[model samples]
Target chain A: MVNDNILGIIAGILTSLAMLPQLLKVLKEKNVDDLSPLMLITLILGLSLWVWYGVFKRELPIIYSNAFAVLVNLSLLSCYFLYRKSG
Target chain B: MVNDNILGIIAGILTSLAMLPQLLKVLKEKNVDDLSPLMLITLILGLSLWVWYGVFKRELPIIYSNAFAVLVNLSLLSCYFLYRKSG
Candidate 1:
C-alpha cells in the first residue's frame, strides 16, 4: 500500500505545480484574454485559506503546497494585469 | 478561535469552487488560448490523489473537496479540448 505521507507529498506537489504551465503559457504568449481575473482571484483566496488551515493543522505538506500555490497564482495574476493591455 | 472543522469545510468549498469561474469563462468565450491542457491534467491528478489521501485519513472535507475538484477539472479538460481548436 502506498504510504499516506507519500500520497500527501505527491498530491501537494501536483497541486502546487498545476498552475505552473498556465503561468508559463501566459508569459510566453504575453496574452491573457482567454483567462479570467475572477478565476485567479478566487483561486488565490481559496489557496490562502488552505494555507491557514494547513498551519492550524500543522500539516507540512498542505502548508508547503498551498503556500507554493499562492505564489504561482499571484504570478499569474500579475501576468494577467501586465499583458492584458497588449491583448 | 475558529473551529478546525469549519476551517476545513470552508477551505474545501473554496478549493472545490475555485475552478468554476474559469470553466464558465471558457464556456462563455468558447476560447481557451490562455488555458493550458497540462495545467488541467496536473490539477486533476493532484485532486485525485487528494481524494485518495482523504479516504486514507478518513477526512470527509478532503474527500468531498477533491472529488468535486476532479469533476470540475474534467469539465475544464473537456472544454480545453473542445475550444482549443477555435483559438
Candidate 2:
C-alpha cells in the first residue's frame, strides 16, 4: 500500500509538471500560433473535473496534481492569447 | 460511491481525450515547430506511469484513460518529428 501511494505521487508529479517544458518553450519563443486553444481549454476543464473527483474521493494526490495542472494550463492559455497574433 | 466512480470516469474521458484538438491541428496544419517534443515525451512517460499505477490499483478507469493518453501522445510525438524540419 505504501508503495502504491508512492507510485501514485510520482506519477502525479510527473504528469502535473509535464507541461512545464512546453510553457518554458512558449515563454522563450513567444510563439503560439501552432498551439490549439481548444486543447488547452479542454485540458483545463478536464483537470478541473479531476480536482472535483479527487475532492469527492478525498484523494490528496489527485487533487493536488490536477490542481497544479490547471494552473499550468491556465498560464499557457494566457500566453497563447497574448502571443497568438504576434506569431 | 457510485457517483464518485462516474465522476472519475467522466474526468478520465475528458483528460484522456484532451489532446485530440492539438493532434488534429497538427495533422491539418502539418506544422509542429512550436510543439515541444520534450513536452510530449514527458507527458507520455507520465501517462505510462499512470497506467502502471492504475493497473496496480486495479482501477479500470485510470488504466484505460491513461493508456489512451499514451497512444495519443505517441502519435503527436511522431508528428512532431516528422514535421520538425518542415516548419
Candidate 3:
C-alpha cells in the first residue's frame, strides 16, 4: 500500500487489537463478571454508527476497519456473557 | 448541535469510553498481569498518531477525543503497573 494508505491500515490494526488487553485478561481469568456490559454495548452501537458514517461517505478504509472491529468487540462481549457467573 | 455534529460528539464519547470496560475490570481485579502490555503500548502509539492525523486534518472531534483517550489509557496503564505483581 501507499504511504497514505498505511495510516488507514495502521488505524485498522490498532482499532482491531485495541481490545486485546481486556480480552486477554478476561480469558486468562476465565471470568468477565467485572467487565462493563454497558461499555461494550455502547462501543458496539457507536462503532456501528461509525461504520454507517463510513458507508455514507463511501470510505472503504473506515468501513472495512470498523466492520472488522465490530467482530472483535462482539467476540469479547460473547466471552463476557459466556464465562460470567450468574450472581 | 446538527445531526452531523452529533455524530462527531457521539464518536468522541464512544472513543473515550470504549476503554471503560477494561479499566473497570482492571480496577475491580487489581491485576493486569495477564493483560497485554504490548497491546496497550501499541494502542497508545497508534492513537497518538491518530491524534497527529487529526491535527493534520484539523479535525477537532478526532483530536480532542483521542487526546482524552490518551489520558484514559495512561491511567489504565498506571493502574496496571501499580497493581501488577511480578510472578
- Report the lDDT tens digits of candidate 2 across residue range A1-87: 447667778888888777788788888999886577887888899888888977886767778888999999899999998988852
Error of 2 at B7 (Å): 0.7
Q: Residues B14-86, candidate 3, lDDT per residue (tens digit)?
A: 8568766677777888978656667777778777766765666555766787778787788788887888786
DockQ result, candidate 3: 0.45
Cα displacement (angstroms), candidate 2, residue B36, comes to 3.3
At residue B70, give the lDDT of candidate 2: 94
lDDT of 1 by residue, A1-87 (tens): 889879999999898788677778778988787677887788788888888988887777778888898898899889888888752
Chain A TM-score, each candidate: 0.88, 0.89, 0.80
To one decimal, what is the Cα RMSD in angstroms of model 2 from the true structure? 2.9
The TM-score values for the models, in the order shown, are 0.85, 0.83, 0.78
Interface RMSD per candidate (angstroms): 1.7, 1.7, 2.3
User: Per-residue lDDT for B1-87 in model 2, tens only?
Assistant: 448678778888888677788788889998886677877788888888888877887877778888999998899999988888852
- Give the candidate order by descending lDDT: 1, 2, 3
* Candidate 1 chain B weakest lDDT stretch, 10 residues: B78-87
